[model samples]
Target: MKEKLIQRYSASERINHWIVAVCFVLLAVSGLAFFYPAFFWLTGIFGTPQLARILHPFIGVVMFLGFFIQFFRYWHHNILNREDVKWMKSVKEVLKGNEVGDIGRYNGGQKGMFWVMTLCLLALIGSGIIAWRPYFAIHFPIPVIRIALLVHSASAVALIASIIVHVYAALWVKGTIRAMVEGVVTHAWAKKHHPKWYREMTSKK
Candidate 1:
């Protein structure tokens, strides 16, 4: 018999995720090129250095808007609760390949990552607008623009680090990537990793 599967993400949700992810990669490369002379060669990824400089802020805007939509769609599922506390406390065991707590649609770490990404995107957008030149930057004082640049850079670094963890966790946890890619998971995967969610899904049938 074929394995039973449960839907985890809709097609649009998966498309939105990949859009944000691609924009992030492009922005990271261009931003790094502009930030460090040693990595100036990275700008070639966008055709030319001048073009990269021009496209970086625009890509940042796209990424921010994409994530903004995602924030609203999944925020409710990511809310922290007693179960999250239990999950966090037993994170070590979870890392050892044991499921912990009555895991819901998301675990403690996933919830925390969601919020962290939200804050970083917020910071990135706000700072990015302030530092955008030939436009908003001229309206702000030099010192203010400098501070905004600092915040933008810091937020970018934090976001990059958090995304690395997110990617790693997706790869480390069996069947996790399928949720975003194919938009479904085997029943066994759902039951083993997210028993509470599994019950909720099954009960609805």
Candidate 2:
């Protein structure tokens, strides 16, 4: 039997998502190496430690730009609504292999993570500029630079944690990863996980 499929993301959207994902992994590995002595070996990801230091900020800029484009593309769908509130309140049930409310393109957890990523990216770029030596850092005072470095580190940790959760959630939910990777999902998958989105898409067809 031929399984029905629905387009969840276009080729361009999937490409952009992957670009950001790759940049994020590179940044996380290098950033951790730079931030902690124990994980300094991770610098090998970008060649030598010196190379990692040089490439970290540049990769960060790319990730920021990539996610910035994604933000504008999907932010509207991620906006919280009454259904999202219901989903959030029943998160425990959601964890027990059940979905809640009339989910659209994203559930409450996905919506929350979207905003968290946005805020973390904003903090990272802003503080990173202030702490980027021999460039914008030179204009800032020593104490201010120290604070920026602190903020940058904290935000990086938060972003890393959030991404970990994001990855886990994607893996935990059946067919979730396929949506991003293949840019399509089975009709059953869509209808089960995002009923409202399924309806919207089907209505258009």
- With a 3 Å backbone cut-off (N, CA, C), the pairs that clash in candidate 2 are none
Candidate 2 differs from the real structure by a C-alpha RMSD in angstroms, to one decimal, of: 0.7
Q: Put down candidate 1 lDDT per residue, 1-205, tens digits, no spaces.
A: 9889999999999999999999999988888899899999999999999999888999999999999999999999999999899989999999998988998999999999999999999999999999999888999999999999999999999999999999999999989999999999999999999999999999999
RMSD of 1: 0.7
- Candidate 1 global TM-score: 0.98
Query: Lowest summed lDDT over 10 consecutive residues: which window, candidate 1?
Result: 27-36
- What are the per-residue Cα lDDT tens digits for candidate 2 across 1-205? 9989999899999999999999999999999998899999999998899998898999999999999999999999998999999999999999998889999999999999999999999999999999997789999999999999999999999999999999999999999899999998999999888999999999997
Would you estimate the TM-scores of all the predictions?
0.98, 0.98
Report the C-alpha displacement of residue 134, candidate 2, in angstroms.
1.2
